[model samples]
Target: MHQQLPPEQLDRLICLEARIHKKSKEEIIQEQFLQIESEKQTDENDRNKQNMDSNKKSDDLKCSQNSENSPQKLFTSQNLSPVQKKSIITKKHSQQKKKKKTKEGQQKDITQYLQYQKKQQKAKKCEQKLMEYSIQDSPFKNKSPLPSDPALEKQLKEKQNQIAISEIKIKELETHNSELRETISSLTEQQLRIQDVVKQFAIENEKLKKQQLQVQLQTNRVRLGEYVVQREKTALVDVWIDGQELREAKEQSKRLEVLKAEYENKKKNSKNKEEQEMRTLNVKLNFLIKEEQQLQETVDRLETEKNLHIKQLKRVYEEEHARFTKNNDYPLIGERYQVLSLLGKGGFSEVYKAYDLQELREVACKIHQLNSNWSDHAKQNYIRHAIRENRVHKELNHPHIVKLYDSVEIDKSSFCTVLELCDGPDLAYYIKKYKCFPEKEAKLLVGQIISAIKYLNNHKNKIIHYDLKPQNILFHLNELKISDFGLCKVLEDDNSKLQLTSQGVGTYWYLPPECFHMGDQPPNISSKVDIWSIGVIFFEMLFGQKPFGQGVSQEKILKEQIIVKSQSVTFPQKPIISNECKEFIRGCLAYNQVDRLDVHQASNHPYFQKKLN
Candidate 1:
């Protein structure tokens, strides 16, 4: 009995065979049926099931060969009808008899397929056995004895050699065929690319031809116009020459034409000359640029040398001055105070640390010198200004205020004022050392400043420290003191009236909006000017920068009205200040003097009132 393959397995095997042969499934199935029938005729004594198995193997081998030989032809073969295909595949025999001629034909057809498979297996086995025998009987080791006669051994060796030769030939043929296919594929790709490039070039060539034709057509039209113009001119000349009265006119016209030609030639020559001059000018411009660059380099070198020279001179001067002060007791002002060392210097005065002869105490002596270039009237005015400063400074007496000691004229040209010395650095030093103070510390320092300013603005002494700044606030053993009364103004009335003074008197950043006003009348200055300055100082103490125009220059500040136009003071995001503190700062930094808090009002603010509670 014959066993049939399962439908699924048959379909899978058929699909696989089709793929291996690179043919349609129908063609692979048809080949399988033919192989089965041929196997049945060849192996008549074997079971019919073995024939089916052998058919699968034969079909696989045939399909692999067919795919390698004429793959394209098999792919293009005509499709068979469903009925014809089914009849060809399903035709079965139940012990059916075959004609003698049919049996012979089937045997002949199967003989080559069976013979080729037998030859392939026989060749592989011979190759394997020969390799094993050669290794076992190598010349490098002991030789094994032959079990056969010499003639038999020679015949077996020849057959092995033939099989080896045939295998090598088959491998070489397969390698050569594969190489040819690769070369053909590569050449075909290159041909396609070349065709594409040629098509693109042909398109561009046609566009260039069209453009050339257009240019030629335009030139022909221009030539025709010129020809017409020349013909008309010649006809007019002929008419003039034919008329005898017009002969002189024709001669004049010819003369005019000759002159016009000469003028045109001259114009062309002038144009050429101008172009040549332009080229010369360009050359000169390049030379000038190089010269300018060289000059700049020279100037930079000279400036660097000058700065080095100035620094050397300053160092020498300082060394000489130090030596002079150490060796001599020369600076005995008013024949009483003995100068020790320089404390600080200012625009119009120099403060020196000195010992008082009568009191035997350390004091700061501020000296003002009369310039030799100043006239007698200027000297008198300066003397009067110094005396006024002395009077205003001597009246101040408070815990936070610097005390005045005495005033003396050192010589005919120089005057010195002595005051109590504060041995510590100014508030500006602390402000620089620490970026900013915490709210509690800043409030404590600001309270001391407010207290001092309040005393100055009292009814008995209506004085305003016009030059109030971080530099003027000194620290004496950690005690805050307000110093420097050079720019202070005195109000005569208890009403705290505004005083007119120099517009550029105090520091611009600290001064109020009213101080920068320019008109027929000078700006009114009052105690409120100090309020605006205190606001800026307090803001700087908390935020490490000024509230308005922090980094702007003084000239720009005036021109741009940075402070005058400021409608409000903005607080920094950092330092996390309270709203009460912000409100107090806003009250002091008001754009209008009338809207601003006075010294008394500012001192009573909630920011300070909280401390009192």
Candidate 2:
């Protein structure tokens, strides 16, 4: 069978065969030329041999004639000598011998030439046979009659058979290649089908996983329901216990009232003056003791009732919280306050417009939610600060300062301080809206702010509002009020300096130059720090931007402050601020703490003294 080969290999084989055939043809042509030369040589020798034979024949004929003529002449001439006859005979014999020798040499030469011609003919025929054999053996030769060489014919037939078999093998290989291609296509189709099956299996697996998750969630819900039922049972038990405690407290209060009435009657019936006086005093002391006991019982009952109410409120709150969680709403506070709307939000506190049920007034309730993420120490510190804020606001009675109505602990995690809600937006809102305030208006606002700051600084326990900024200043009916006393520090006396424990406590833009320190311990600053902040706000109000400008980062600001020491504060001339106003701002923003104006001095500046329509 023919073995299939690459096209290049097949072409290479064909070329090799053609080259071999051409080489053979060349060798055959050369051999044919040699044979032709031999034939020519043989023909030339035969011709020469023929010519020599003819010449020899003629010579022999001439010699015979000469002999005949000599005999005739001798017969005619009787007077001839016997010696002449003998000499003639001798000459004739010698001539015949020479002719014979010559004839023998010619015959020998012809015989040798004939034998050589026969050999040449045989060699020529052998070369013709070899040429025919080569032509027959050539694989590329066209089909034709077989040559006389039997061995060559046999070889040619075998080679033809091999070529036919090779063709058959090539056809078979093509068929096999087609079959293999079909097999490969079928395998690819099967692989695609398998991939589709795997995709379907993956989808089914995802559905099964979702089902499992749903079942788990259902189980969790069932557990939660059980827990709620248990909580309700516990609450009911607590209520019963509180009721029993309330009844006992009421009984004790009734007994104390009876003993007090009896002691009063005995005092009225006493006889001797000194004894009566002594008895009256004793009765009075007994009545007072009984009253104290009754009050204690009442307090106990009230505390128990309060606790029960708180528990009920907590349960209600949990239910509300669940419902509100879906709507993303705030949880209800205690029954005393109803949240109206969110007023504002800060990092640690959220202010809400809430209606106070006890006071029957709308108040701004600042709620500080105790974050669970904070460390214990941080939470404690925050709580202390809140308490301090409440205390500070309670002590302040100034008109330009925000009033604290009440502070309530809503829960362990949260507390609410109800404050006086301002009638207008904060100074920051106005600054944003107007870009910059009118000089007159700014002066009025600054003056009010200074008045409040002065009040805090002049208090018996001098207060330093370290976190003073436009955002912390609220406007009520266009009157400025200083609020947010969370960072307020109360000094022992007016002469005492405020020692800061923490750095970067307030807004960076408003922080004084001295506030930025290099050590772990914060710098000890004075009330003039608030003055510097006032100056910054004053500059912002006049120039529509901070004195140091905006967009730069806090680190850059701190570095600038450290390097320039507040000397970098620039006053622009675009707004045409009066010289007095500029000097006043400069005085407040002085780099040296001693050189900086106090709140009292700032409030009485020539800028604030200007009359406004």
Candidate 3:
């Protein structure tokens, strides 16, 4: 029989043999059919040959048996050894068994060959059907199925039913799994919500506990105050009683002295009568002496009580003052600063006199509060203005420029800028008090201002103090210090001639004509604007009033075009300002920006350069 391929090789041939050998499945199936038939034919032939051989062997064995059974053979067998005779008999039996075994094996082989032929026929028909289906519907199909036999179809149907049931079970399991996941997610969310609630409760509890503590403290303080008041009242009553007792004791002592004098006089007149009177007077004097001793002791005790009361009151006052300072007198800022008093208040900011904790010096804390009511844009502009102020002020280290110590944003709504504290009054207050300044003193002060301005303009980023005014200028130890850079402008570079976006941003009286210029396009502001402001300030110092727009509202100044139309500045007759100073002021207050003196020119002017006579 031909060697059969293993199941793996047969499956490979069925699936991939066509692709490898470039033969169709029909050709491969036909070859396999021919091969199976040849194997069957060979097997049948081999079985028939074995049967024929068995028949021949049987015939030979029958002859031998017949010969052995003959009488002559019998006499020979009897004469031979019993062992030989037994071996002969056993060989005959072995031959018969071999014949029977051959017959049985041949029958088995025939049956197996028939079964294999039947299987091959069925397989051939199935393969033919699969090839037909593949050609008809799916030529390139990898897994074309064979025609269904009844038994195989039944099994397949059962298997499909079982698979469907298993799929249903899998779907149910998936649904259950999804439900479990949803439940787990819900539980986790609940846990998170509970945690958040617990945190809120904890915070509220802490707040309530703090509030309870505060209430208890207030109650205790009230009780302590009542006790102190009662003590003070008792002390006052005791003082009054002591004073009354002291007066009564003094009267008694005076009476005793008067009686003694009377007794002496009587002794001079009548000796016996005077002796009786002297005894009475001596007894009265002894009683008065004891009463005086008791009164002195009471007085000493009263004095001690008075001293204790005074000390207690002083301590109480000190504690109240300390508590007030701790609670209300100071800003909410930590230990960094202690606000002493409000130095000044402006439209958008407040200045407080504060003691710096780290620097151990008094500072002016300018606080800007961004009101919630303000528009978002306004708040942003306010913050940007403060930032610009900090940027410009921090770079300056001039003696006349107010030193910036620290700048901090307290919160979203508050900003603080700490600056050098000027102990003396502002220039406005000084001008108001003196009505005007002497040309000599004004020269000294104005020169300092000009020098600071010169330094500012000469900086890499030219700075213009747009809002220079008497109120913004401060005196620290009688030295002029310029302050309040909120409305100041910074140029890109020294040669930058950038137009001013904020057209009107200074005190109307101090603003130059260019600042008041109204047109389609804003004017380009330079150091000349500051020079005009300096002239205005100098004119005010000498004449005690603004040259162009004194006591004029900004609205009126804009509406009337006061600064824009002014041809020249006029001086007061009573002030009698010198011509040199007047000429300097005129140069500063020139209507045209080009005609206005620059800070350097103004600084080197003969008025400032001249030595005091």
User: What are the RMSDs of all candidates, in order?
Assistant: 42.1, 32.2, 24.4
Give the C-alpha lDDT of model 2. 0.71
lDDT of 1 by residue, 490-525 (tens): 888565676576786678888888888888888777
- Model 3: lDDT equals 0.72
State each candidate's clash count.
Answer: 0, 2, 0
Q: Give TM per candidate.
A: 0.47, 0.46, 0.47
Per-residue lDDT over 1-613 for candidate 3, one digit per residue giving the tens place of the 0 to 100 score: 1234444455454559688778755566666666656655775787799889989978876787777667775565358788997898799779767755654554454345446557888999789777866685666555655676999978987998799899999999999999999999999789767654554454455457546755754453332321232256447332222234344555665665676567556646665566677687667667756766776665545444444334444444443444223466445344366565556667787777776655556788888888778999998998899888888999999999999988777777877888999988778766765657888898899889998999998898989888888888999988999999999888884664668788756678777777777789988888888888888888878877878867888899888998788998777787776788889888998888778788878988887767877
Q: Which stretches in model 2 have alpha-carbon errors above 4 Å?
A: 1-332, 559-565
Clash pairs for candidate 1: none
Model 2, 178-238: lDDT tens digits are 9999999999789667654554454455457546755753443332211132256447332
Residue 187's lDDT in candidate 2: 95
> If both were scored by lDDT, which would come out higher, candidate 2 or candidate 3?
3
